[model samples]
Target: MFLISDMLVRIVPLCLYSHTGYYARFFTYNVIGGIAWVAVCVFGGFWFGNIPIVKNNFELVILIIIFVSVLPVVFHLFKRRSENKIITKPLAEVVEERAN
Candidate 1:
């Protein structure tokens, strides 16, 4: 899962950086980031998976984790949408007035 998602997410940036001749720096950063990611995820799950609450309410815990992970993404999308609307609305009205 992590491998697939990481590949999908990193593919474009990796290509762009490699194209720009930052492959060495990108490779170092990617290696460090990958190690940290694995360590955090493995240790975090090992530490948390043993908890009685998490073990008992596994589905709920998973749901909460998914919700927390998605919250920021949803917020950023909404924020960008609102910003686009604000920026475009005045310009659209001006265009309409000019056409009239």
Candidate 2:
């Protein structure tokens, strides 16, 4: 997640409301979410992974988690490429809009 912190659902609200004292709001959200994530992952693994079935399939579980975590980022990159192409438009269209 740190690798793509610059691009997340968290960043959108932070940037959009930056001028509205969004620091406290964003920080609170980040702290709570971070703690929840760490707690769930650490404790869940500590307890659940001890199960015979889970222990035997630990590698597969990890792979699934990694795939779920990275899926959003992969989709975001694909969407961004199409959005960039649409946003460029043409110089003449821009000049015409400014004239209006």
Best by TM-score: 1
In order, candidate lDDTs are: 0.91, 0.86
The regions of model 2 sitting more than 4 angstroms off are 1-10, 57-100
Worst 10-residue lDDT window, candidate 1: 83-92
Give the per-residue lDDT digits (tens) of candidate 1, residues 1-100: 7799989896988898889999999999999999999999999999999999999999999999899999998998999998876444677898988899
Provide the TM-score for each candidate, comma-separated: 0.48, 0.47
Q: What's the lDDT for candidate 1?
A: 0.91
| Ten-residue region with minimum lDDT total, candidate 2 | 1-10
Candidate with maximal lDDT: 1
TM-score of 2: 0.47
Q: Clashing pairs in model 2?
A: none
Candidate 2 residue-wise lDDT, 1-96, digit = tens: 775875776577777668687888878888999999999999987999889988999889889989999999999999998787754758899899
